[model samples]
Target: MNNEVIVTCAVTGAGDTVGRHPAIPVTPQQIAAAAVEAAKAGATVVHCHVRDPASGKPSRDPELYYELVDRIRASGVDMILNLTAGMGGDLEIGPGEEPMRFGPGTDLVGGLTRLIHIEQLLPEICTLDCGTLNFGDGDQIYVSTPNQLRAGAKRIQELGVKAELEVFDTGHLWFAKQMVKEGLLGEMPLFQLCLGIPWGAPADTGTMKAMVDNMPPGAIWAGFGIGRMQMPMVAQAVLLGGNVRVGLEDNLWLDKGVYASNGSLVERAVDLVAKLGANTLTPEQGRKKLGLIKRR
Candidate 1:
């Protein structure tokens, strides 16, 4: 395993995790606080998702993103900000009786409209979910087609933001490479191999290896798994010559019956990386590795 590894803490996900953990940060202030805590715990980057202050549901509000970024910067914690531009592409189709009809929980928007936060805040890194997937336990789908992805990537690139090509499976990897080939991404393409998110890729060594092997040449990448596979994938990612990501977004439990705070999850990943004889990268170091430029 390489001695240098970058650790990213996905502070708050756009999932139904608020009900599972009472401490999950719903408000912008709480999310920023959690991110600051994770940075203090040795995370190189904080992957973010803003939630509605009133309903505790996910939101694509630009003001919330601005507020979170402002607070993180004000706290004086040096960490890379990675905002998600993947939220506004959801398509929750109704059951067979009304398959084509818009469902009750649908929140679909155009690709450009989805990136309002990234456009305004101009963070160093923003996620570009490479393709669509049938999200777990629901008839809902996270839709990101080829054309939609192309538009998102083009917009982020135009803004001089590094795109974290988030790939859930091999197909996503293929599309990401296609983006690189089409000049949508920069020379040193960056990728995040997301594993074990329900109906997507399975959380295992073989699956991780396949994703890593299929990565485009000259690409910088990170790999992570959900729940029990979290720490295990940390080791696996190190062995595979990639960075690691950990947080409540992917896993809710610290143990069998324990709910984990974002800070504790990041601390656990730090220890695991150290135990493997690897040194975790700081935010600045990670920026250089991933070809990210921190713009104020």
Candidate 2:
């Protein structure tokens, strides 16, 4: 088990979770506030995804991201910022024989287009989903071809922003290492093992351990699971010699029937890590550990 851990709170995801919880941070202001709350509760990093203020739907507008990051910085809260570059890859296929007609949920775009916010905002870290998957129990799929991933990884490296390679399955992990081998990624790569998301890797002890065992040497990695497996994975990740992630983006409840705020989830994670004889690292410590140079 790691003696020190970095706790990352994914403030708001692009999932359809709004209105399902009392506080899901819809607008930029709300999202920023959630990040600050998580930081105060002992989160070393905040993973953010902006949403439409009016409709509470996921958005990829750079303006919204700018405002969110700006608000967090202006608050004077010390936390490593991690932006999601996984948007703009949603492909919602049409039902039945009209497969050519994409559904309204589709927001597919080129690889670089997805990084517009990252290029402009230049957060300390941004995620690069290593591969695609059948995202959910629908016609929707998250598309990230190998070539597109190569281009995105290269651009992120050029921008001097740390790329958090998000691996959802063993194949994704394999391709991520390939990118490193191809020199598309920089030294000391960061990875996030995503589990229990619909049709991705299931949140099982063996599955997480297998992924952890396959990570490249000298890499900084974190792991998280969705829904009820969130807290369990925190312990699993820490005991398996990696960092941990927890937030409303992955799970909504603090207990069986209780809804959780971003801060509360982080607070619980801090306690869990402490119970396991590991202390949560500060943002500065996390930066040093991950080899990240703070920007702005």
Scored by TM-score, the top model is 2
Ten contiguous residues minimizing lDDT sum, candidate 1: 287-296
For model 1, name the residue pairs that clash: none
What C-alpha lDDT does candidate 2 achieve relative to the native structure?
0.95
| Model 2 regions lying over 4 Å from their true place | none
**lDDT, each prediction:** 0.90, 0.95
> Candidate 1, residues 1-296: lDDT per residue as tens digits?
66899999998899988788878898989999999999999999999999999988999888998898899888888999999999888888888888889786788888888899888899999999999998887788999989988999999999999999999988999999999999998779989999998789988999988888888789889999988999899999999999999998888889889889888999999999999999999999988888888866
Least well predicted 10-residue stretch by lDDT in candidate 2: 212-221
Per-residue lDDT value at 82 in model 2: 97
Model 1 RMSD to the real structure? Answer: 1.0
Per-model TM against the reference: 0.98, 0.99
What is the Cα-based lDDT of residue 178 in candidate 1? 95
